[model samples]
Target: MDVHVVSKTDNNTHATFSLPTPTSPLAGPSSLRIRPSLLSLTSNNLTYALLGNQLKWWDAYPVPSNAPTPYNDASAWGIVPAWGFGTVLESTIESIAPGTKLWGYWPASGHVVDLALKHEPDEPSTHWIEVSPHRQTLLALYNRYLISTSDDETRHAWEASVRPVWQCAYVLSAYVFTPDPASNPAIHPYPGIPSVKETWTSADADLSRAVVISLAASSKTARAVAHNFTLRPTSGGPLGLLQVTSAPGPIQSAATALKPHFATRAVDYTSLDTEEVAQWIAALKPAKILVIDFGSRDGGFEAAHKLVSQDEVLAKAEFVTVNIGYQQKVYTMSDVGAALASAAEHSKIQFNTSPVIEAILPVQGATKLFAGLEKAWDHWLENREAAAPDLQLVWGEGVVGEKGIEGAWTRLTRGEVKPEEALVFRI
Candidate 1:
């Protein structure tokens, strides 16, 4: 069996190892023996490794004790989970039989894993939750799995690459900055999570009378957010939008294709003029200004911050910063430290999809919420070519060699993967 492991302390230090396959029977009742068949690599995967210890992502899948030498040390090396499809080869639970296709989190490898799962009562028959004791600390979003019905490989590939992050975009638009406050109350940016104490009132979620700026506007999540924003009723708010990205041409083309009611403009990071942007935003006469940072390049978020903090006309309006992601690169220990410190100092409303989904489930119900999400997701999938014309899936096979997941991980660590490429693997 093949697997990939990364150093817990240094993401750049990673290798592909061929471990002996497990021969023991399923570990617990309702266990399924599964192997990740299709998976993807994105900057978000890097974030999972960088924040693994803090977020308990490392607990989801631990290295086997029998692996060779130091590579087997759980404290030093761990598997980074990826969002993808897994095929069940054996099952203790009768309802979920062998050959069943499941979609959710999986180790970024071809090795089979045994997971104890339980059906989520009152939810769709397709919904199952991982009940493994080792995974208890993971966010509920990661624990949950869905049975997949589609056989289309292209669609599956796209889902593997885009669906996970796109859901965050969906929640941010449909729940966080809710279009209809009466039906779906706007959730706190942190929402229901006890660790985050900041409050998010309706006033804070109101984009109806605001000018919104998205840094790293070409990012998949950012583009999805922009697409969702186009669906909002004109009466709901957000008088205009300013997108700052390195590839402004494609961004502007997508905005044009979406045909948002609100005014829209895209500018490259190098060409962004804070004063000019402030003047354009001031003309909108917004009641507030919201700056969403989706892992912008160096100084991109800082530039947007300067526009709202220093501009005479723009400073008068309410200012809010939502920290959604970090730049796509391997982070050093000092880089991680500085990011944590900066987030604390700025009081940035950090967005976590799990807590926000937990808060909305009761209000919207699992059926209604998931139904709505699927409808939106299906539409996006159908129109993805128009929505993200530049995105091209770069597929690889298996887990060990240069043209496989190992190579993909190396590219990610060195930041060689372009924003236009979506890396997927057949394992």
Candidate 2:
């Protein structure tokens, strides 16, 4: 079996190594021996490594004891987890039989792994939670897995690539900036997490009278957010949308295709004319302006923010900036430190999906919430090709060598992957 390992101190330093697969008996009772069959690679995966220690992502998968030389050191090397589908090779639980497919988080490796799981009570039998002691540190969102019933490999690949990020987009649009506040109360940006003191009031979430500016608008999560925006009722808010991205043509085309209730405009990051953008916002007569920085390029977010601060009419409106994602690049230790410090200085409302989902589950029962999400997810899957006309899935095989996960990781480190290409591996 093969697995990928990355330097804990530097994400760019990574390699694949072979390790003997665990034999016969599983690790613990109710545990299943599984191997990741399909997985995805995205800039978000890079964020997992950059904030691994702070967020406990590194704890999800430890390097095997039999790994080669330096890679064997848990303190120095770790396996980054990816969202995808895995098949059970062996199981001890009577309810879960071998060959059953599961969808959730898994190490970006082909090696068989053991996970202790418990059926989530009061939910569908298909819903299970990872009860492994080492995984307890992870958020509920990461530990939750769903038994997949779909046999369409194409849909499975698309889901592996988009579902994880798209869920964040759904929660952001539906709950965070709730359209029907009566049914879905506006949730704080850091809902259920007391450590973060930032408070998001209902007024702040009211997008009805606001012009939303999305930085890094070409990002998968940003694209999904834009798509979800189209689903909002005309009276719900968000008077207009201004998308700033490197590739504006595709985004503009998608907006045109979606026919959102509000006006939409797409502009290149390098060609953002603040005067023109200010005029666009002023014409809308918005009472507030929400800028969502989805980890734009170096000066992209700063430039977009300048438009709001410099314009007299726009400056008077309520200005709110939500930090959702980071740029697609490998981060050094110092870079990670600076990012945390910068987020603190800017008073940015950090959007986390885990706590938000946890807060929503009790209010909107798991069954209902997932049903609504599945409906929307199915819609997105059907129209994804039209929505992202330029985007295409690039599939690879196995864990090592070129045309595999290792090569994909190398390209990610160099920031060579294009925004339109989705990388998935058949491990």
Q: Name the runs in model 2 displaced over 4 angstroms.
A: 192-197
User: What is the Cα-based lDDT of residue 346 in candidate 2?
Assistant: 60
* Per-residue alpha-carbon lDDT of candidate 2 for residues 76-163, written as tens digits (9 for 90 to 100): 8989999999999999899888988899999987888889989867777788999988899988899999999887788888889888
TM-score of 1: 0.96
Compose the digit string of candidate 1's lDDT tens values, residues 127-176: 99899888999988999999998888888899999999898888888889
**Per-model TM-score on C-alpha atoms:** 0.96, 0.96
User: lDDT at 218 for candidate 2?
Assistant: 88
lDDT of 2: 0.86
> Superposing all C-alpha atoms, what RMSD in Å does each candidate have to the true structure?
1.6, 1.6
